[model samples]
Target chain A: MSSKEVFRPTCIIGLGLIGGSLLRDVAARGATVYGFNRSTSGVRAAIKEGFDVSDDLVATLQRAAADEALIVIAVPMHAVGDILDAIKEHAPNCGFTDVVSVKAEVLRLVKDRGLEAHYVGSHPMAGTADSGWNHSHTGLFKQAAWAIAFDYAVENEDPGKFWIEVFTDVTKLIQLAGAEAIPVEVANHDAAVARVSHLPHVLAEALAVVGDNGGILAQSLAASSFKDGTRVAGTSPALVRQMCETNSAALVDVLDEALILLADARDNLAADPADISYLADAGYRARTRLNARSGAHKNSVSPVKISSRPVLRLKPGAYGWVSTLKQAESLGGRIEVY
Target chain B: MSSKEVFRPTCIIGLGLIGGSLLRDVAARGATVYGFNRSTSGVRAAIKEGFDVSDDLVATLQRAAADEALIVIAVPMHAVGDILDAIKEHAPNCGFTDVVSVKAEVLRLVKDRGLEAHYVGSHPMAGTADSGWNHSHTGLFKQAAWAIAFDYAVENEDPGKFWIEVFTDVTKLIQLAGAEAIPVEVANHDAAVARVSHLPHVLAEALAVVGDNGGILAQSLAASSFKDGTRVAGTSPALVRQMCETNSAALVDVLDEALILLADARDNLAADPADISYLADAGYRARTRLNARSGAHKNSVSPVKISSRPVLRLKPGAYGWVSTLKQAESLGGRIEVY
Candidate 1:
């Protein structure tokens, strides 16, 4: 640990998949992590697995107050506001942040509560289909982007530095998993996610409706493509419902646009077979470009820093001769060969 | 080997991903395999790997005829017609089958040429994003559903029974990998694939257009949701185009239905938030069911089969524990309590 590395007693409220995962990653990085959850069994499981957890909100807040650690409200979006209110009553002096999918509304709530300076809105674009602490792992955040939203209060009061440092620490853990940090505006981030994330959920659900309508036959014949398309449909209904309600406008915009595209393609296909070919070709080109870019980005990012090492190559058609020469080279030492 | 296991010289034409994979799986079960390909390198590579491979189609066909083996056509959909014509002219005596995505058109072409009882249509609903022989593996068909489509002519001649046995042999190899065999009408199979397979490609490509219009920033922000939604887009453009073109009616019908569903959802989201929740919940339920079903299926299938030796569990937890225990129990060994 560096001398300048700031230590904050971190309180992760809700020991679910994201919360528990953050707790594990932060604790492993030498942070004092205190987890709070409603589920007694969940808390017990976390403790048994060697995590610093608690069930008492009062005591958790007191400890955070005493240590002056940041409180990360890592709960469902609907419960976040209430949790923040509870935390405010108990630990007013503590710094606050959240790990939620939708950010604009949460930021609005923080501002309305007059906790603007104390709170920084954050959303880590990382997760899996599974839920609960049992499914949480320490490496979940590695290589994922953690978006942090700031306001005038943070920048003017020099609180931005503290928030940045906290986010940097969080990003460091993410970097370990080969993820990158992307700074985006709360509205922009929400809009982006609405198009790419929430809209897919809608489409998947809509597609599922077709499958449901098709009866048992469609269900049995549902292959990998259908499975992949509807994977997001497996997410918590409550969570998805909350997201749709919270980010209704942006999702509507994206969904409307998608419908327009789909309707156009459908019309074109109905008019001419060649039109369908154009749509398919367009999709193929887009997918190819996305994959190529994804590959290039992955190659560019080194998972770990590598120390300088000597490189050696063998000439083609010289397997035996190269092996004999490499043997002699190894006897002399201080040389690397491939 | 069972006495009932039949031996026949099999010639696999166009040794690409599916062809090459089938060749390897069949050979492992003690069958004489002859491979023919346009690419000399592909033939050379197969021969080098100790398989009987030849670049000359006529020579391979003559050898297969001399041995009275079945010939399997594994090539692109558009090329199948020409290949069939060539096969009728060159290897008229040999029994024939195809592993094509669209079977109706191919079946029609075969019937038009009066090659009754000479060929059967098969579609193995399994593939990866990759193509060609280099990506081929013996386990490719394991547990995957292979659809065998027999027309009236073949069925009346009792050729369906013969083809079914050959398919059963292929299915056995796949069953070794933990796959299933499904029989359906060629038209129905094409229709089902149009919904499950072709529709996804169109949807993915449509989604990709969103990324393209928004530029690099849009694509970079595309996380797993976009990746999953667009995974089919990564498939070969030429192949997807052919699928869309060849199976136009079914693909158009599915796409039209999908578009209507999407449009309805979009309108509901814009006008009625309450209805959006219903859509979202429906999706959640469908996805949950799929995930549970897939997980259960994966749990029941064992990795490898051995006659005498006990199979060891690969991992201690939820992933591999069951298979290990089942293998051990099957070997007549009792698990000791520690």
Candidate 2:
């Protein structure tokens, strides 16, 4: 570790899929990481996978506090409150982040609980439908964009402050784990993910029910589109509920927007036979943009590599770091530090 | 070829992805097949890939007319009208079916044009975001479910008739291409695919617009769920429009249902922050059923492979063949002669 670097000794709480994968990636990179799982079976599985893990949360948190480790709460959104409380009691001074899908609720809860000092919110845009320790593996986060969120209070403060330093340390840790760390504001993270992530879960659920309503015949007729649209419906309902329920405000906003679009499509289709042109054309244009920007149209995710990553100069604005990270993301870059 | 089999000499029109792949698969299986492409470039590409293809649609139809070929119309819905007109002038006696996504509209068009004698509707539930002869491959239809639709009057007609023979030939050809052929009523096919296929296109287009509206940060944060949910948005806009516009009636029905579900989810979340359990749990159960029955949970499309397909007895229902084929599909079986 460098003399001034604060990016070592990762302490991951809730060693399920994301946490176990983090442990694997960090340990494989020869970085120090200790993980804790509430389930003894999860700990045993992590150990069997040759990862350092414990079932004792409080003790691990104390060790994390002593080592000044970067703590990652890699649990579902609903489970985060308990983990946050445990951290507050045992590892109050540790630099911490989370991999929850929703950011605003967790940020609010952290602030309300007075544990926001050493906190920088995060949500790694990774994972499969499967969960648990055994399903986790190294390289799960490779090339994935991890959203590192800042509180609104961090805008005017000097970027050299301890909190900003903690965030930079978090970004360094995220990059080390093989993910592209995109900086964002807490409010933006929640709203953006509400569209990209949370709404998908909701839509997949509705699609699943609709297909099932078509019964075995429809299931037999189901092809790539149906399969892809409902793939996320296979996720555990508990996690899905937490994702939708916790980000309820942003989710409701996107949900209303989606409903409007769907309703317009339905009404237009009813009135005119070929009026789906509006929906289809706009969607086609949007997909073309996405394909051009992200190379997501490829069979694999292949964002163009920029050899020289231009450093972001935080512009004078309300939450400049959010746009800074977004700019870097558009250029296919990640942050090591602010 | 077996003496009892009337299946041979396949004539495919439209050398796009599905048509080109069919040409590759059927020819590789040692079936006598000739493909017709309206585009000279497509024909050139197919010939370059070592397949028999011609840009002369009418002459190809004339040759197919002489050979008593099983004609397959592999074009989009709008294009099918001109092709059907050409066939009426060139090879009206040939046994024929279509691979259009929407079945009822084409069926009605065929009937209205007095070309319904040997016509059936078939949709091979396969394809990628790509198109054209160059993007085609041999194994595109491997393990896919091809929905074969029947006329309602066929329930009372003897299964040994010439039309039934033509239908059986189509199924045999589908199986030869390594796809399961499920027979369906024309009306039922439209409704079922509205839920399983068409609605997904509509939904995916809406999702693409929604995500793009979230701007670049949301795109950066997009993961597998978002990717999967909006995948069909990358399809050709004309194809998407045709699929939606041709099936407007059924699409509207399913779209309304999907809208209601989204609205309910939003209202429920607004009312009780944690009440998404209904939507999530229902979706979870539906996906569970799909996974269990189809083994769709596997990385590959695996329906439990049945070693012996039970012969479907024509039940005394309103449409026996439809139910019979659906029953066979539920057991991972395909109709060889029903």
Considering every candidate listed, which one attains the maximal lDDT? 2
TM-score of each: 0.82, 0.90
For model 1, how does the per-residue alpha-carbon lDDT over B137-224 read when each residue is reduced to its tens digit? 8878765555555344224533444444444343333343334444455766677777767777777777776655555544656678
TM-score on 0 to 1 scale for chain A of candidate 2:
0.88
> CA lDDT of each candidate?
0.67, 0.81
- What ranges in model 1 sit over 4 Å off? A1-6, A151-179, A211-222, A296-338, B1-6, B153-179, B272-275, B301-338
Steric overlap count per candidate: 9, 0
CAPRI-style quality class for the chain A–B interface of candidate 1 = acceptable
What would the per-residue lDDT of candidate 2 be over residues A40-127, giving only the tens digit for each residue? Answer: 9888877877777898988999999998888999887768889889999999888799888888888888988987778888888999
True contacts kept of 1: 0.51
lDDT of 1 at A329: 29
Tens-digit lDDT track of model 1 for A193-281: 78777777777776666665554334545667777887777777777777776888888787776777777777776665446666677
